[model samples]
Target: MSYDHISESLTLLQKDWSVDPILVDFMLGKRTDVTDHAVKVGQVIFHIPYITGEKKFILWKCYWPDCHNCCERQGRLPLTSDDLITIGKGLKYQKTSDFVKNETLVATWMESGPSGNNVLMTSVNLKRKIDETESDDGTHIRCRFLDEKGACSMHPNRPGVCYLYPFSSWLENETGRARVHSTYQFTGDCPGFFLEGSLDSMKETLKEYSNTIYDYTMKYTRTTREGFSLTSFV
Candidate 1:
């Protein structure tokens, strides 16, 4: 929870993370990009851009994550009435008959920055923790539909930020060569991660339309919030 705790965690993973020009700048607290932008890893680039981390978490990463890139640290996704309906229907939570009755009990969703916050973020900010909680910031709360056993029953509909984890990249150097730049270097309790393919190969793996989808996803998020988090769910 202290600043050094975040920085120290990242420093521990010294060899694991690979750096690129863009990532290096962000990690160094220089320039930065929104999480939606594509990151150049190795020869290929990933559509998952520099999504933001938590503010305290960002402080941890900035000083710790051992990230030398200047990519944006944390972000929150916005919520729409449609998203609430889709999520509620998908999770079968507070059913249609109960939805109208209980809907008012919950706000459809709350907005923060580029990444949408979940209940988890809320509890943490308030010093409360719940295994079933969604990631949250102090501002809003977004809940994930759970399964019978209480797992993410509707992960496919999970927020874009949730999907793009431990994944961030940027065009480094003036040439902007795409690459598998920064790896998760946090020594914190973050889980393990590995790109399915080499950073370079992953870039070439995308289809034409896939790139379009990637670009569109980045459009809505803006650099509204400025704090960062150093925690990694991985």
Candidate 2:
């Protein structure tokens, strides 16, 4: 949870021959050559070239049930319109308004607009439990859906943010073409980093995550631009 621990872990990982040097460098801010390319599953052979200028392989596999750090430490779980609908239905909520009122909280923050000006944006995020859980750093709240067994209660219809844990993406327009660029979200809590993962499974995960992230971003941006309020859901 602290930078000191993260630094120590990176140092320990650096000694492991199984760990990829490029990944360690990237995490240490030593390398900034992260690639912005389309997700091509077929072209991938072994390592994902998320970072260009090198042939290094960085593999990861989620250690869920064993490690619920993401669920416990992730502060904000922003939801898109699709997530609202899907999760609402999954929870047996008769109306989106009811789900929004009972299960979410509206958060307002400043973000850069298209003209590079600061604009206030509001988002609907899944509400966390009120009780605080003590950790090595201090205390933090867990997602309301996270159970005592460290499993998601609404796993089948979890939000896009939950689906894309430890991986975040953004869209960039290059020569009038939209490109989705993804990067590892190193939180120092995920045990999956540097671990072996099946290429086929990784490809499938990337394909779904890529699509979800794109849709989530577009819908979230639209909601922000349209100035949708919590009352609008009703």
lDDT of 1 at 67: 36
Runs in model 2 deviating more than 4 A are 1-55, 109-121, 130-140, 195-205, 225-234
Which stretch of 10 consecutive residues in model 1 shows the poorest summed lDDT?
A: 120-129
What are the lDDT figures for the candidates, one per model?
Answer: 0.33, 0.61
RMSD of each: 13.2, 6.9
Q: What TM-score would candidate 1 get against the native?
A: 0.33
Off by over 4 Å in 1: 1-5, 8-82, 92-151, 168-199, 204-234
Tens digit per residue, CA lDDT, model 1, 1-234: 333544444454444654333333344445453343445433434444342431111211222234322112222333323344555576477664353244322212332222333322210111111332233332222232433343444566643333334433222243673222332323232323222212343444343323433432332122112211112221
Task: Output candidate 1 Cα RMSD.
Answer: 13.2
